[model samples]
Target: AVANVCGFIASTLHRGIGLIHFPTTLLAQCDASISHKQAVNAPHGKNLVGSYYAPIRIIVDTDVLQTLEDWLLPDGMGEIVKHALCQDVDLLTYLEEYDGALNDPVFLDYIVRRTIELKCEVIDIDPKENKEAVVLIYGHTLGHPIESISHRMGTACCLSHGQAVAIGCVIAARVAFLMGLAEESIIERTEQICAKYDLPYLIPADQSVDRIMSKLPFNKTWTKEGTMMALIERPGKVFNFDGHFKCPVDDATIRRAVEQTMAPFGTIIKGSGSSGALRKNKLSNGDLASSTITTPIGSPMEKPGEGWAVSAGGSCPKGDC
Candidate 1:
């Protein structure tokens, strides 16, 4: 889908036409939003038609999520899970433990800000995929098939993109373990976290491996060698390539593994019973997390390592970092 869009935009520009990308899916915000990748499906595989064309501007407005289906939330979460798997334990913990707080403005603000910071960091490090910045695809090699199948089948009984990706994460984790890139614990942790958010760890039932494989060649990441799957070994460490195993299984193994990791719920994290009590104990301001780690309510810029770290070891004040 992304590759095709890019091709259309590029081809049109060559012939004197204009193209604009407005991504409503959750995956769009995290990965697809970063660059120009358009794709379309064909008999051989998923994205058969595509090209790269940078957009004039990429706009992300949280308000758009308001009208989206509840299932779509997890679709976006695939990207979030990928980001968390890469650089932020805080994010993983938050999603696994305090995801209920997401409804709170304060919590959402922190998440939004953190996401922006992470994206900026990645773009800064590698505006072009000339380096390891490509690690962003940690769970995507498997994820693309899930999404392609879901999209190809349409919305009726198919998994949404985010759900497919969530399941893909599980598949990647298992693959990681098989290749010795990641430990069993990480796979369990990934599954546990997804469960906390009500995301399915297993692939959708009845999904055919051959069906998904049929779409693989068209994927943007596909190469002359074969499909490449990115597996997470540890936070910030990703391993990618095509044929790493001595005894690689067929598509059936892939389908079965995906199913084994499926979760019963969808993706929105549920509030624990204490959620009401926490809301009831609201502070005067919206700095709930910050309020927990304070020191003497000290004056602004008190000293180094203090709430307000001022130079010269003098109190600078509290308002600043």
Candidate 2:
């Protein structure tokens, strides 16, 4: 998000500043840099302080991606999968059928361009994200809170942005299926793609669902009526209410979906337990295979990373290198 901030700084200071972006990471190349929006995370919430300032130009350099840690390659694919869910099933099909190595630079460049094309299509319809573009945030409603709250907690390592969003996409799909907004196939396909990419499909044990609930109100999707969520009907189709892509959701309903998502795989959790504790933490494939690594990407904090080598999860890489 250093590039995101620089774009923001350029907007805040000058007449466009003729700012140009040379996005290096898969995350930026595929999703972050394509947007006309330039924002940074805040102590209060994600992307809370920012503006919509289009860059003069954005150049994707897949060659720069040669140095990205292998663990980081999948980081951008979360958004790509999300784009497929929002409006491109063929893209999803390609990813599902592909068996090649993800480390292939050729593959990386292809997917990056593909993701940018999808994002641009959405941006063309709603450049400001006030309408259709919000669909691009398919996983972020719950994902943001999960990532944000995880950062504040100390018991477990924080979930990377990709991991958090991957889980968030599953939750949104599952919630849609629960609400009858989507069919069971939607949920299954969502989970299947996430698992295929090796993205985390389960919430970490360290996170509190209630805490996640508390943070929902701060979401930008909120209106005086309540929060709205981005749910999909099928691959390439988002659930639309009236003329819009999101629908207003109540606390009781959203909480139910969140709890159900946190529940063990196929077991639908009833209400919270009688004694005020949650149901038995029945760990499944997700929990069983999960790895809680120290932040793989120490990026985009409200406070900029100081010179090189601040620390493991908080240090700036430029300083270390």
Candidate 3:
């Protein structure tokens, strides 16, 4: 948080160059690298304080990802899946056909480049995340809450941001299906892709449905009138119910979607126990203990000044940089 704030301040003060080295795939493909956004988490919500600050240039080193543990690979795939669903059908096909070769540097480079390009296109259209750019947040409406709550409960290692977004994709697909916007195949494909990457599609048994639902209002995507979510009708196509790209989704629909998404994994009985399919291959406590969180470096902003400042090396004061 301090690094990003420092970077944001430096960019505002001078013409800075932001060099981001993505150790995890998620940081490479998602908000950390390409977008003109900087933010820090607050007590109320994630990314509660932020501003639009695009970088002069972004450098993605695929070799850096080679050092990531196997479990960490899915974090990047979550964003890849999001891009494929919203903008690139070919990318979706690639994921389905080459699920086994996900770790290959060549394949990883291609995915990262393509994902970055897709994001760049969106940023060009809506640099401030106001209109068309909102589509980029296809699965994040629910994904953010799951991530926030998981981190708060100290289960973030068990449920990483990428994993939560993967689950969010499934839930969004289900919601689209329920609204008669998306075909049944889309939902199946969404779940299949998540499973292919060993990412979570169902909400965990421990998370509270009510709590997740309550966080909807606080989402950054919401407007003054109502909650706006980016729902999809098919791969590479976003659903636009009323001509506005950001569609308004009701609480009842979101609740139903959450319930149905959780139903397949298990039935949440009152206060006692869940009955149904037991969670298989759950992450061991040791694995969770060893898990680490990586925050993306903020992009630099173009301000008139003399020199450039880079925030690299040394420990972050907040211990979360």
Candidate 4:
């Protein structure tokens, strides 16, 4: 937070002023530190008011991470996993086989450096997020809403940004397979990685389908006709074969993805219908026939879980409502 505040201030005060980033948190070190997006939250929403400013140089030390709380360490890994899923097959393998904490010098140094390289691989191509860079946003489509709703819903536990995005990645992979654009391995591998890290891949019963869907920031993802998403055909590659990074998808698919994600172990392969049989694989320890998620196209879905659903600080009260 200080880096963003100071970085943004310095950028606006004088263009010639330069800053070097010494990010302390795992999230900052892995993702936000390298990111040129510097922003401050408005009274209404986060990152709503700010500028994109790059640091002059970023210096990271695995030693700094020792002071961080255990819960916070996974925050950066959420993004690291996203990068691997989108760009690097080897990084994905590295995460799968390794078992270590942020204090493990070997894992810490390699991942912190690897994440930076993977991110730059894309951001360098489209620095301003005009295109391509959005691959980094793979899980955030639903993750942002999940993160916001977790805190606002008065749940006993709030999901960290990393945890929420980890769930979102699982849902995205499922979304691709549901749409018949990607193979089932995408979903399986993503879910496996999250489990390997002990990250929360299942939505808590408190986080309802309605609240999450309502809060999704689809201003960039939605089009006039329907919604679009940055889905991957497989690990280390995006499913944007149409020459556009933003792939078109039906509205029902996005909703179903949210619904399935909300339900515990909810991944039903192939709509049991007349079009054709899909390559189906039920999630481990998941019952294909029992989940309330069993619904046909356009049917009334699961209601929001019973709880107090507060608007996120009245973000949609008047102007944007």
Candidate 5:
């Protein structure tokens, strides 16, 4: 939090070079390096106080991802899948076809570049996240709360930010389907892609619906009127009823979506271990069995020994080390 404040201040004070080195695939695919956003957590919710300050340049070192455990790969895939679902249909197809190649450095680099490119296009159009860029928050409405609550509950490793967002995407897709905005097939496909990537397609039974619902009002997306959500109409399209990209979704509808998404996973949650069938399925596929450590969300810098460490040389002036 202190570093975020300092970075924001630095960006405001001078035009210094801001270089970001993303170690994990999650950081590369998600907001860690690509976005202009800087945020700090508030007492009420996450990222309640934030500003827009684009980095001078962002660097993603795919070579560092070789050390990333298998469970951690899905953290990055959540954002990759989110971007593909919101903008690139071909990216989605690529992910579906090559889900098993997540550990491949070449493939990982390609997907990371694609995800960054998609976000860059959105940021180029709407740097402030008011219009076109707002769609980038596709699954984040529910995803954020799940992430924060899970972290507070000491279950951050079990439900990483990416895992939560993947499930959140499924929930948002279901809501879109129920609202007649998206097709049933899209929801199924979303679930299948999440499953293929070893992501959770349903809400975990341990996550309290009431607790999740209580956090909705405190979301950073909330306005004076209500909470704004990025609902989808299709895989490569966002639902825009009015001129705005974000639509004001009522609490009741949100609750319904949460309930519906969680309904099917009850048996799996109860029958299998706390890790759920998803972990079992991933294990069956010969993926790594080790659990993952917690990572910072949307923050570029991490504690030493947590993520990839900087080289012995000084800071990277350009994106290249």
Candidate 6:
């Protein structure tokens, strides 16, 4: 499906025809739109063939969502979850208050407005993802690995992109908490939002932990080191602490965290077992410990002049950089 869609777009570009994407599926709307456009496909995974080209325009008509299925609504909700966590806390509150009634004209309008505004804000600052725009990938780094490996295992429908990302955000937050960049409350808050929307909160224990971790090194934004974890400073901001944490944390810690977050709901993989499913592997029962992450060399500490200084002191609402 994706290849055909991309082939059509590529053909049009070759013929000098401008491309405009009007994604209707919740999966297409959030995940496919960006993944198809930005991330290129690698030999090991999907979406390896692509370029960064801005669409002439994106029209996310809420009315179109009226015919969506129950599952599709949550798929789109995952994007809302991402936007809320990284960019707008108000949107999180709104979703928490209203139980995903995207069919409502007023609610759909609100989501479309906020989603567009958030994307535009990201573009205005760094459309090309050159500088701090890395914040837009808050949940994607770890999430993609999960999706890729799942597909590799022949369980393509196992998890959606947003579901993988919804799980990844909590994992990233847990890493951030370990680094002291965020508090436990923040992690809990993230969980609360995910739970409200029924997003996947953990990975299946039977998943190939090794294969999933392998995908980390392929990140274009990653440094030479395999370590890549985004540090959450505040809303509308994320520090891509590439090479900050250890490459693969101990199996014990990974299992504990993955299982703990997932216990509330059923096992990470719900429904019937697939034909090519692997045997169940268990996470070791032991203490999971992570120390504080330090600043990389040449990347100076947060002194007066470090990072992008938008303005000095009380200039911006969130306080000056």
**lDDT: which candidate is best?**
2
Residue range with the least summed lDDT across 10 consecutive positions in model 6: 288-297
Per-residue lDDT tens digits for candidate 5, residues 89-156, read: 89999888873567887887788778878988989989988899987899989988766665441121
lDDT of 1 by residue, 119-216 (tens): 66765666544345565655666666655554331111245455556667778777667666678888888878776656666654334444555555
TM-scores for candidates 1 onward, in order: 0.64, 0.80, 0.76, 0.78, 0.76, 0.70
Q: State the displacement of the C-alpha of residue 218, model 2, in Å, after optimal TM-score superposition.
A: 1.3
TM-score of 3: 0.76
Pick by TM-score: 1 or 2, better one? 2
Residue 95's C-alpha lDDT in candidate 6?
80
Comparison by lDDT, 4 against 6, better one: 4
Task: State in Å the error of residue 127, model 2.
Answer: 0.9
- Note the Cα lDDT for every prediction shown: 0.54, 0.71, 0.66, 0.68, 0.68, 0.55
Ranking by lDDT: 2, 5, 4, 3, 6, 1
Cα error of candidate 4 at position 221, Å: 3.0
Clashing pairs in 2: 308-319
Rate residue 137 of model 4 by lDDT.
79
lDDT of model 4, residue 196: 73
- Clashes in model 6: which pairs? 40-47, 40-48, 41-47, 41-48, 41-49, 42-48
Q: Which residue pairs clash within candidate 4?
A: none
Worst 10 residues of 1 by lDDT: 301-310
Candidate 5, residue 16: lDDT: 44
Q: After superposition, how far is residue 273 of candidate 6 from its true place, in Å?
A: 14
Count of backbone collisions within predicted model 3: 0
lDDT of 3 by residue, 210-275 (tens): 767778878877665656888888899988666667887788888788867762223221210010
Runs of candidate 3 exceeding 4 Å displacement: 1-26, 154-157, 223-225, 263-321
